[model samples]
Target: MKAIQAYRFALDLTPARERDVLAHAGAARVAHNWALARVKAVMQQRAAERTYGVPDEQLTPAVSWSLPGLRKAWNAAKAETTWNGGRLLVAGRRYPSSKTCSGCGAVKTKLALSERQSECEACGLVVDRDLNAARNLAALAAEFDTAGSGPVGGRGADRKTPLAGQAAAKRQHGTAFAGQTGTVPPQGGTTNRVPVQAY
Candidate 1:
């Protein structure tokens, strides 16, 4: 059996390269914030529609917050910036980038956003939090794509493009209702139903 291993090295970037990298990071942050805003807006709209007694079919649909979902929206909006046609290496939201130590592979129980450095109790190693996370992520990608073929596919790329002018499907309503018993009429008629059970 062939064993798999990975390693990461710190980049010695020129001043200009450092600046360019920083700019790209800033752009990524902006894109993330923008996607979050869109998701939140759709959620708020759906909530408001439900409060206004809008029919389930008539309510504005919800947007996905998954990496692929966010990537799709980001790709659609990429034209707004100079970053286009680039492969996106999105780590899973639940991946503990900051909590894992790159030196000894010890996982921290808790890490706060205010802490700028990661101190591993097991290894007694002090590393800049963000740099440690970046190293860990690079190793993760290396291990995930063992062949070093190219960017991993079928995550964001394979998702079906949402229809234009139509919102994504609303998975659930804020107003909780049990036992899916209501069905829309075929001839476009409203049916009187029991009030929803609200928390």
Candidate 2:
């Protein structure tokens, strides 16, 4: 016999900690909803295409529901959203802009909302929080320009889905299994091999 053991622990969080936890949960909910909406839209489009007699190969590419797939899609969309005109871009939500130092590029482990200014320990540069964040974003854009690479949206010009007629062919119409007539008797059995009649 095998035995299984389980343990549960309760968390006692402070007000700030509780808020942080809630914020993370809210962010997760938003991501989930966004992915769900994308999936639903694709499905609806495919269904509509089917009603119009569009072949399977012509339907929209299916959205992946796996965690990594969803994460990749989310990252691409977030990158596109933050992108502005040439060379100027805003950081995505995941970027710790305000917590990052514009002078030395050092990132603080924690930055409270009440902190209006950012002070870097490495370079000893003190600046307004928002200004520091903006500077960091500008630096990122400059780095991209120097590297001869545009932002994420500018790259990956290829279509995410397959082109028309590139998808797998539709399944053929027929019985999928070989035992449609009924079970066969053993080779040496005495029972007659009469085909079973369907009602």
Best by lDDT: 1
Q: What is the per-residue lDDT of model 1 for residues 45-153, given as tens digits with 9 covering 90 to 100? A: 8899999999987777573555678888787766443243234456899999999999988999899999999999999999999999999998887676533344434
Can you give the TM-score per candidate against the true fold?
Answer: 0.34, 0.30
CA lDDT of each prediction against the hidden true structure: 0.67, 0.66
Q: Residue 120 in model 1: shift from native, Å? A: 0.3
Clashing pairs in 1: none
Model 2 scores a C-alpha lDDT of 0.66
Find the 10 residues in a row with the least total lDDT in model 2: 158-167
Every model: Cα RMSD to truth:
27.7, 27.1
Clashes of 2: 0
Give the poorly placed runs of model 2, Cα more than 4 Å off: 1-90, 146-199
